[model samples]
Target: MASSRIRTFPQRISGAMAASLGLLALLVTVRCNEQVPVIMWTSEGISLPRQAPPTAGHIVGHQQLASYLEKALDVGPRNVVLFLQDKMSIEDFTLYGGAFGNKQDGVFPNLEGALRSSSSPLVLPAVSWPASNAVIGQLQDQLDTSPLYMDPDTLSQLRLNASSPALLVFRLPYGTGSDLLSAKETLSGNDEVIGQVISIMRSQAVPYTAVYTGLQPSRKEAAALSVEGGLGGGRSLLQSRGGYKDRWRNRERQQWAKEKREVYAPVEFKEDDRTCMLLWAKGLTVGILRNNRWEEHDLTPATFGEGVSPRLHGSDCDKSKARLVLNYENVLGHRSFKLVFVMSQRHYKVSARRWFTLDAVELEYDGTKATFNGSRSIYAPAEYSYRCHSVTSFRWPLLVPRSAKDPANQWRVSFDDFQIQGFNLSGNEFSYASDCAGFFSPGIWMGLLTSLLMVLVLTYGLHMIMQLLTMDRFDDPKGPGISVPQTE
Candidate 1:
């Protein structure tokens, strides 16, 4: 009985171990198959009709107007009349012109020629020009005021109740009282569209010219004038009359100069005339204690250099056993802090390549110093990739006391995105200028390979173990010895 018990003991232990592994795999499968709720419940939601936002119209400047006139007159002799109308939008013009002609093959025909040929009742008058003496005199008179502005007498001659192949210049008044819309309505009533008047000069046969100026905020500004006093009032407040656009530009300049005087810049420290150690962060941010809460403040490259000082101590060329101290002061509105990085060099087990590792982090802040002792330590290799921004960011959540002896009343300080470089470095400039290394790191691939190898080894060992399950020698005192049958 003792011999039988000893032989079966190993089998019982093997069965129990296999059962536990099977249960573990089953639980993992169940956990993976679990579905997370996307939406727990639904409620009645209000549906509102959507309305498009009002868009402003673009107006051509004086230079563009001159370019258009020069191009139009260069083609042939044509009467050119430029209309400078305010409060009329380009959208209104495009829409009203489309109603005149039926679109041919899903595209509108040249509406300009169509409108001009049918212009029997539309009133656009002709102006007669004289020799160079009168032309040069008129040009010289309006040059001081506005070259585009014509006197009311010249403009008054443009009123003919019927349409003629003549130029008509209309200086539509701004504000709520505008005559341009009424003129547009009159042209539409006469079965003539006013929008396509510009394209009439595009053809050689056409002899008339109409220039349209689509201005904004007059039609739209009527609504905003009551609510905002004026459309430009808010913008004028940001930019003062003195032409200074930046309201805090001078204050920022002064603060930068003050910060320049407060902190020392980083300098390259040469060790044993062999290697150089210089540290700097591309980005830095700190949580400042304000109003019993933490407010975030980002430090620019200039401000970061003015506030933080990097120093290397110890005489190790690899900088593995050296101490890297990053002292920050006059930052976060004069809050001083120090970070000590204890580094070490580690090599991959399968390769000759080596990289640096952060062994520990010692923080000094709020008049108290503490070494961070946590379950998660920075044991991974310091990422180093050529031409990449392979930064190793460190975040430390620290407790700062309010007073010297006040333990309960403490403020939490968070240091985030403290990306430090130049660990175990030797050169004039920094390295790793772009993104980090690839997604599946070497360590992750190694782990997956190792797990697969372990599974294969376990499978083979179980197969060999199963082959060893031969029945114990059983001899019967009969004619022949009975053997246990092997069943798969």
Candidate 2:
């Protein structure tokens, strides 16, 4: 019996050890599931939004949205939407009015038509989103004591997940309406913020197509670690410069053209006036006026949104790929003017900052005055203007794509600031501008720094240890040898 027991013990121990090893190997493999990189676009240079934006009904506000996104959209700690929490006050309408206060209270704006098919708003049907208690609990602190205008981030985040994030949208530089450019121009420093958002998205290889609106605060201090380098001037209708909108479509591969409501672009010149600014075609640039001042006025009637330009035929013009010549002869002594053409949409999509190179830029105005010569993509090189001084950027224009086969009106195109550079002259993608991603992204730079730091530290530590040991060993005659028998 004793001999049998010893034999069984060895067999049992061997089986258990094999199982343990198998489990350990599995856990390691599972943990090694590498995360696919993601792109992030924070409105106004702020990646984490602190305040709740008035979006898709604050039925649930920011607090709820953040929690919902953290669980559903983010893959791990490294991939979640990070909200910058803040406190603010809204009107406590419940105190001022009772149950019958607002006529719209009982009638949900979006669900009014389906009321008969469902229960009353007072006791809504069981929802896929969190219970009202869960959402309100998360927001209780950030929001004021107002009952009607309660914060609802948690609820929103839940709802966002239930629906298709691919279709979720953003407003232009201003409020969500037609006047995208004027709304954007009202607030300055837009260029700087845009540059930052672009770089981060590009480097992480974020898959969603994006949109942005509102003024960029130019007063923001330079940040050693800021994605876009720093803020602009800190000007705007909002109270502070940062923590505005920390939003992103939380889906894998958010295709643009399929989801974009508005258009955005980064430019170097505000108004490039060189030619008569007539018939224009596609290629991604607007025409320059003769006066050297951009004349990208509202081609769209006041009734239309600023982002929407009048049809090409509406302006009584045909599709033509015109050029702007920066000749000193055209540089009128008295008339300091330029023209910006709002080309049709056969080619230019008025999309977000991706990547492109300024192959050749020459100043041609019927004379040998200047030449736009360069091999690099940065349009604003130090010697940029010196070589083409006379071409002082009527503040560049953009070419709205033109479809040769479409009716003239169908091909009509117009853009505002934030639009295809109705004013901004630079032809760089916002994603890579100023440490932001224009033609480039911020993730690329950050990844590079991270790798370099790791290499340097590891290499230096080994060198120091070798030096310490060698210093003492120099006194030994046989060079610190330890003997051991050879094994066949």
Candidate 3:
């Protein structure tokens, strides 16, 4: 019995050891297969979009609609019928009509019938145009007899001074089955009538809105339509220099002012102007414009830390122009990024300091780009009313991994085409760091701890095995021992 128990002890110990090793292997496998979540940061805060679709039956007021029309169709007429037709199916068209309050007034049986009996104020005149000048003269005589047909100039002035007109709503028949090409052909055939109607509207200075219910258009088709309708030429009414001024004032009122401000002087770079070098490195192309000329340079690992100083003349000198410096500091497990922008100018007899703010910053990594709108300002203190310089520093968290083994984590910094709002930089340089930390990340520390625990467990198991193998069996002679009983 003692011999059997002694042999079974080693087997039980081996089984337990194998079970522990298996559990550790499973844990390691699970950890290795886990996916890491990515986190992004901006000045506003962490951004996460609400996951709900917009509610149905939302009513957009008249003022909101006017704003939309001004932005989408330009500041011309408040009322205009924009027919967006393409190869999309009718089913796709039904999905887009909620914005204008899709209330049905009447439904025409077919497209031809719809055009003939269309309630649209713009189309009605075109439908009723006289075919001959004699007919037009007859209508004019009838109009002259009525007191309503007073002076034409007065009528035009009244139309111009009138408030915005009501929205004209129309819906296509549910089963038109008409393709985009066919619909376009039908409208093109009526071009003469359409042109006459447009001429009359422009002459009268009246704004009218019309909505054409048809198939939805793709992005390319929409862009083409916008160009054809002259909707792409005008500047947006909502955006202006005054908007920025208001933003600055609001920031001041909210007590969000920064410690310093960078006051940048005006600098213009024309396409044909050649003054600075154009640097191309790692799929990034930067055009350095200086002194009315452009110079070209290539950025690489070898030239990363080196600074390029361009020669300036007259007003283009460093004292009058903004200077931007880009630096990369390699630290343990990651890389730190910093952007330093300096603005300097000569001030005379001014005791007060000037303040300027950076409105936005845009960064592009490889092919992906992100824009951040955070205000960082600097104050330009006068040096005895002679010279003043203000510096603004922007620091970004570590981005690149420190481990060379992680080639996937390596990223090349590019700022040649980087956009810094509210200032046009005159010069820039890339600086690199010489020293970096090794195995400094939290993940590395956790891995080391796990490995140390595993080693201790393995050592304990081996020590137990050694102790069992060298144990004195004869010490327990009364219970279980190796004895030659027959010989005795």
Best by TM-score: 1
lDDT of each: 0.37, 0.26, 0.29
lDDT of 1 by residue, 269-333 (tens): 56667434444444545444478776655544433554443533432335455455656666555
TM for candidate 2 is 0.24
Kindly indicate the candidate among 1 and 2 with the higher lDDT.
1
What does candidate 2's lDDT look like per residue over 1-488, in tens digits? Answer: 01111111111234477675444333222211111111123222223322222221122223544454343333221221221111100111111111223433321221122212222111111111222223333333222121111112222322222122322211113222335344334222223333333334334443332211111211112111231322223222112422333122223113333344233221222223321221111122223344554433232232133253322221222222223321122232322222232222122244322222233233223322222322232232111121121121223422212234322212222323222211122233221111111433366679889999999999999898878743332344657664445971
* TM-score ranking, best first: 1, 2, 3
TM-score per candidate, in order? 0.26, 0.24, 0.18
lDDT of 3 by residue, 237-284 (tens): 312434885465456434422322221121222222532211222222
Runs in model 3 lying further than 4 Å from the true structure: 1-98, 102-254, 257-440, 450-453, 456-460, 463-467, 470-488
Give the candidate order by descending lDDT: 1, 3, 2
Q: Candidate 1, which segments miss by more than 4 Å at Cα?
A: 1-267, 288-292, 297-319, 330-336, 348-352, 370-424, 431-488
lDDT (0-100) at residue 196 of candidate 3? 40
Candidate 3 TM-score versus the reference: 0.18
